[model samples]
Every structure is written in C-alpha cells, then in structure tokens.
Target: MVDVLEAGGWGLLAGSALLLGAVLGYTLRIPHQVVASVMAFGAGVLLSAVSFELALEAYDRSGMLPLVLGTVAGAAAYTAGNVLLARRGARHRKRSGQVRGRSQPSEGQQAGSGLALALGALLDGVPESAVIGLGTAEGGAVSAVTVAAVFISNVPEGLSSSAGMRGAGRGKGYVFGLWGSIAAASMVAAAVGSAVAGALPASAVAAVTAVAAGAILTMVADTMIPEAFEEAHQAVGLIVVAGFLVSFALSRA
Candidate 1:
C-alpha cells in the first residue's frame, strides 16, 4: 500500500503539469515559437530518459530478447492506435490548429475531434505514467529522471493540445475536463503498474519497462519532433541537445 501510494503521488505530481499547461494555453497568448522550443526540449528530455533510464535499466535486468520484443511490440501498438486516431481527425492533436498549415476542422469534424483528442492524450500519457510505477515496484526510489522527463514533456503536450482544442471551438469546460480526467487516469495507471509489476518476475518487469520506452520513443518522433520543427526549425536542434544533456546528467546523478 505504501509503495502504491508513493507511485501514485509521483504520478500525480508529474500529471499535474498537464493541468497547468492547459490553464496557460487557455488564458494566455503564448507565442508559437516559444511553445515549439519548449516542446523540443521536452522531447529531448523524454528521449534521454527512455534511452538511459528505462531501456538501459530494462536491458540490465533481463537479456536482449525481452527488451527487443517488448520495444517492437510497444512501438507497433502505438503506431496502430495513432493511425486510427488520425483517421478520426486527431492527427493535429499536438498542433495549435494553426501551426501545422492545415486549416481548422469544420463544425462536423469539431464534434468528434474533441473525443479523439481526449483519447489521443490518453494513448500518449498512460504508458509513460505506468513506467513510474515500474520504477517503484522494487521498493526503491522512483527514478527522478523519468519523473522529470514526463512532467516536462506533458506541459507542452497539454498546452499545444489545449490550444488546438480551443481553436477547434471546444469549450473551456471540455478542454479542462479532458485534461483533468487524463491526469486522474495517470495516477491510476501508476498505481496499477506498481501493483502489477510487484507480482511479475524480473524478466516480465524488464519487458514492461522496455515497452514503455518504445511507446514513448515513437510518440516523440511521431508527434513532438515534427511540431517543434514546424516553428523553431534549426534552433530546435540545439535546444533538444541541451535538454538531452540535462536529462543525461540527471540520470547519472
């Protein structure tokens, strides 16, 4: 119970950033370039965390087979889901509705886009939070690198997605409610991940961690990097490298 609570606490702490970003997006007039830079930085953070913290740890725990299979499976799953969501009008979920060069969806598309956006957020967030629980299942301290990466990355995701929802004519109620629910779900995912991992064998735990790493890697490539490059362009590369170095330092520390 203590472990579960601890994991949930950490999960909530990270997930809270989404709500913060949502509020900022709705209330502020932040520039696209700034959002893009931050998004790129966050993506780099996540990349480093996935490589050194999650995937490396998983490799050290079990052998190559579990790590490779799990990663491939995770990436495949996320790709399939993303394709479905895209077909349903959530392809620009990470955009500000105007940043991607695509026109705003018509009224008919707006009605269903909100639901797709909510689901897309869930698909992106749940696996990341689950790994937090995996980190604590051994009764050790949760990985600070993973927690920080998730929190930092989620801020831009929430901000950009909320901005897109707003531009799509979504109401404040729907936008906030969607993020709030997803945050709550993140807490639950972390707790459940901890509980489940505690009962699994070491190989299984490693596979699960690898799975999360793969999903996160795919997400960063598919959604985040493109959006960042859309606005920040050449500067995003430097910002990403800086973010990666910071996360790598945290992992070492």
Candidate 2:
C-alpha cells in the first residue's frame, strides 16, 4: 500500500509538469501558428511512439489477441468518452443559451472552452496515470521505459492543453482550473494503474498506446494544425515538421 501511494505520488507529480507548462505558456506569448506546429509535431511523435514502442512491444511480449483487443478497447473507451462529453457540452451550451450562432466565440465562450479542455484532460488522464503507477510498481528496466515514454508523450500534451486554454481566451482562473483538473486525472490514472497491476498487466499498455495515439491524432489534425495555419503563413509548416522530428528523436532516446 505504501509503495502504491509512493508510485501514485510520483505519477501525479510528473503529470503536474503539464500544469507547470500551462503557467509557462502564459508567459511565453506563444503565437497560434507556433502552437499548431508544436502540436502537429507532438502528434507525430506520439503516433510513432505508440505504434513502434508501446503497441508493437506489448504484442511481442504478450500475444496477438491481447494486443489487438486491448488496442480496440482503448480506442473504444476514448470514443465513448468523447461522444458522451460532446453530448454533455452541447446540452450545457444549449441550456445556457450560449452556443447559438457563429463560432466566433462570444465573451463567455472561453469559459466553455476551458471547461471543455478540463473535461478532455480528465477523460484522458485516468489511463495515463494508471500506466505510470503500474510501471513504478514493476520497478525495473521495463518500468523505466514505460515511465519515460509516458513522460515524453505528456510534455506536448501539457503544453498543447495550455495553448488550448489561451486560444479560448480563458482567464487565469480557468487556466488553473484546467491545469488542476488534468493533475487530478493523473492521480486517477495512478489509482487505476494500482488496481490493474495483477488483473490485466499486458493488455493495459497496448490499450493506453492505442487510445493516446487516436486522441493525439485527432487533436493535431483537427485543432492544432488548423490553429497553426491561422496564426501564420505556410512557411510555418517546415517548423512544424522540425518540431515533430525533434519530438521523435526524444522519444527514441
């Protein structure tokens, strides 16, 4: 139990690095195009990591059914969660009479965006934290790799999250709220990881890989890439590719 707590604490601390990034993003005065490029690059790296490292390795270590099923399960879980949130968000907007008309974002729209970002993080964090906790419990070379991959993938995610908040024009309160919620998700993940240690170790890694990949891909293609183009000219595409390569290198390292 003590070990589990310690692992959870570590996982939460690591996840909180994301929040720190959000605060730093406030100071950096990041351009929208830059954010897009970074997000795209990060997405590429995440995709590569999930495909080459997490998914492939898990299958190698375990077998076909567990790997495939786990991957599908992870994707399904993410889809279901997002679908539910979309419905809820729509309803929330409808109730408040807020989401009507053009998407130019009226004054309070930012608040909605902040809430949306927080909601997304909360949904994503559980499995992530769980993976970290399980890695720590394993306590060996494998643990090191798992922790490192998760840590790497998390950096861009944190920064991108903050970027989302800023883009939405969320105030400091919302910024902190989003960050706090994401941190809490890390803790949730840790709890889930602890619980799954014995029951479904092998499948968990594969599932997480798939889910993270899908989410990251959607975010880059849909949100970040578009934001980048909106902020600057087409020249930024090169920069975006460079960022992707940099992240890929780090992931490999």
Candidate 3:
C-alpha cells in the first residue's frame, strides 16, 4: 500500500543518519571535543524526545501501568545485556577515539569484542528506529526530534565503535558492511513498526512506546552522558542545554 511505501521512505531517511555517522567515523579523524559536543547535544535531544514524545504519549493514551511495566522491563533488559557485554571487554563502546580497553586482544578475543560491539550498536538503534514508526503510524510523518536525537548521537557512537573495531583489527570492508547491515535492519524495523502500529491496541502501544523510552533512557544514562562528560567535562552540561534548545526550536518550527 501507499502507507507502507511512505513508511519505508521515512524509515530510510532516518536510518541514513546512522549510515552518515558511520561513514564519518570510518573516514575522518574527528576531534574529541567535537565528538563530545555532539554526544551531549544528542543526549539532551533524546531526553526531550523521551519526555514529550514517548512518556507523555503513552500516559495520554494508556495510563501508567503499561508505561511502568514497559519502562522497567526495557531498562532492566538493556542494562543486563550491556553489562554482560561490558564484562567481556567491550565496554569502550562510547569512546571518542580509540577504545581505551585492551588494544591487543588475543586473536580469539578480537572477534568476540567485535561481535559485542555490533550487538550493542543494534540495541542502541532499536528504540530510536521504533520512534520513527510511532510518528508514521500516527500520520505517516516522522518526528524531527527523534531523527535528530538518534542521528546526532549515532555520530559519536559510530565514531567510537568504528575506531574500536579497527583497533580490534577488523577489516575496513567488514566494518562498513556491518554498519550498512545494521542501518538496513533499523530501516526495516521502522517501516514494519509503521505498518503495524495502527493495528496494535492501546496496551500494546503503551508497552511498545514505554519500552523504547525506557531502553533509550538507560542507554543514554549509561553510555552517552558519561562519555560526553568524560570527553568534555563541565562544558558538556552547557552543550546538552544547547542541544535541548535547538531541538525544541526545531520541534516548534
């Protein structure tokens, strides 16, 4: 149907942001301050997206029960999985430059580390991509704030992850291919989310929205905020504020 195609189009538009970030990460030597600034800004934008878009939307439609359960489950799931990966020496996922962890993993550990990073990246993209679907479901439109938050944050994440993968000795071909695949998968999830979103009941909507909200909040708190602060220190707070302002302005516009 036309709606499906439209949803697919929106999904591709949003997913392309991550691909752009990946390309930047692989090809350029972006400065750490620049990376930190983008991360902080992205975090702020995501905070707003969570508050106004996800939480408020769920509360308005389905009340608090689904919201609570969904949020808690999402946060818990992401935290547990991320912690497990971190323990496996893949914790430097948000590094601005090279991973500060083990530079020379045994040949065996290299693939493991790469896989962990890839999984982590996938987890990061899911909620954001789902958000694109939420917008399309409502009106076949996408939220600019959601797109901005996901896109901006992915720049630093891609930079760091790509750098870490290379440091782990992953080939360039493999690196691009991995990111390209993830981008494609995210686009598909968004498109499917759009196509099916209208069919879901209120409770299902609440669960899905709240779950995405919870996972994003946890991921930002765990990974993005800390990395932003680490890279930019006191300035990171201001950058976050600026990001919020910019996103707000865009939303209003």
Model 2 / residue 110 / CA error / Å: 1.9
Which regions of candidate 2 fall more than 4 Å away from where they truly are?
Answer: 1-6, 25-28, 83-103, 139-174, 191-195, 199-253
Ten contiguous residues minimizing lDDT sum, candidate 2: 90-99
What tens digits encode model 3's per-residue C-alpha lDDT throughout 135-253? 77886567877777777766666666666566566788888888878788777777788878888898888888888889888988987888788769979999888888877777778
Counting clashing residue pairs in each candidate, in order, gives 0, 3, 0
RMSD of each: 2.1, 5.5, 2.7
Clash-forming residue pairs, model 3: none
Q: What TM-score against the true fold does each predicted structure earn?
A: 0.92, 0.70, 0.89
Can you write out model 1's per-residue Cα lDDT over 28-121, one digit (the tens) per residue? 8789889999999999998999999888988999989999988998899888988887788765444434545677566545535556656766
Best by lDDT: 1
Residue 214 in model 1: lDDT: 86
Q: Which residue ranges in model 3 land beyond 4 Å of their true spot?
A: 93-114
Alpha-carbon RMSD, candidate 3: 2.7
Estimate the overall C-alpha local distance difference test score of candidate 3.
0.75
Cα-based lDDT for every prediction: 0.83, 0.56, 0.75
